[model samples]
Target: MKLVVQEFLTLDGVSQGPGAPDEDTSDGFTRGGWFVPFVDEEFMEIVDGWLAQADGLLLGRRTYENFARDWPAMTDHPNGAIMNGLPKYVATQSLTEAHWDPTTILAGNIVAEVDALKRQPGRELQIHGSARLAQSLLAAGLVDQLRLAIAPVVVGRGRRLFPEGSTPAGLRPVSQHTTKAGLSVHVFDTAGLPSYGIYEG
Candidate 1:
């Protein structure tokens, strides 16, 4: 199974809370729902295509709990059925009882556990809004592809997708498109470790 990360970000790379006002207010993040204005048919089509190819979900505790609470009840949503039904693998040590059905907790050595998941036979093990988990995967070089919908807004401060001190890696853009709402949707393939060089001009 290939591990793919799909995320919505602000112009400044903030991925903290793009869904709702109270989606993720951790650390006093007041700029939630920054991606709401960029929603359109093109955006939905792109997102739906990604979700359609998901064989399972790899999520962090916060995202898991949030989705488990909301998605299951949103039968009317376009992607609710898939979100509720797909197998979810959560990385956490504190979650004793996962109320969501078909949830597997990865307690020890998340990188190893996810590595095993990638070896499994499946379409794609997708990671949604699990910023912390995404970072860990990225550091371990476990993510195969990344699909980012970059909104044209800057939320000054929030949990960013690519933060300071993150492992540097080379990425090749496989595809890119601009939505009617001015969102830049890009798909990039991980191109191994980054290389350094100094240009003399």
Candidate 2:
């Protein structure tokens, strides 16, 4: 199984709480549900397709809490229905205390655990809205693809998916499309060694 990490981010790279206002305010983030305005049926259609293609879900502890609390209750929505029924792999040390059902905790070594999952026969293991988990996966070269829904606006400051000193890899674009509402959805296949190019000359 290949691991695909997906994120809905602002042009400035803020990935925290793209759905609800009170979801994550730890960084004094006031713009939580910023991506809702740019979403249309076309955007949703693509998301639905990704959800259907996933063999399992990969999440961080905080994102697990958000989905565990909301997905099961969203039976009326198609995307929610799919999310509620999928098997989930969570990255956390406090596995014994987490309350998410149908989830397996990754405790010993992050790379080894995810590597084991990849060896298993499955469609694709997906990570959604988990910046920290995504970073770990990226650093280990375990992430096979990146699906980014880039919204138009830029929130000056917020928790970013790829923070400074995390990883400075370049993504090779495999597919992309800009929505009618100006949202750019880009699909990138993992490429060469993660490198940083700084101009000093």
> TM-score for every candidate vs. truth?
0.97, 0.92
Clash list (residue pairs), candidate 2: none
- List model 1 lDDT by residue over 28-105, tens digit each: 988799999999998899889898999999999999999898888999997887888999999999998888988999
Sequence-dependent TM-score of model 2: 0.92
* Model 1 per-residue lDDT at 145: 96
Model 2 ranges with Cα > 4 A deviation: 194-201
TM-score computed on alpha carbons, candidate 1 = 0.97
Candidate 2 local lDDT, residue 189: 91
| lDDT to native, each model | 0.93, 0.87
RMSD of 1: 1.1
Candidate 2 lDDT tens digits, 1-201: 989999999999999878878888876888788898999989988888898899899898889988888888888987876687788888888856655567788877888999999999999999998988898889888999999999999988889988888766667989999988888999999995756789999
Best by lDDT: 1
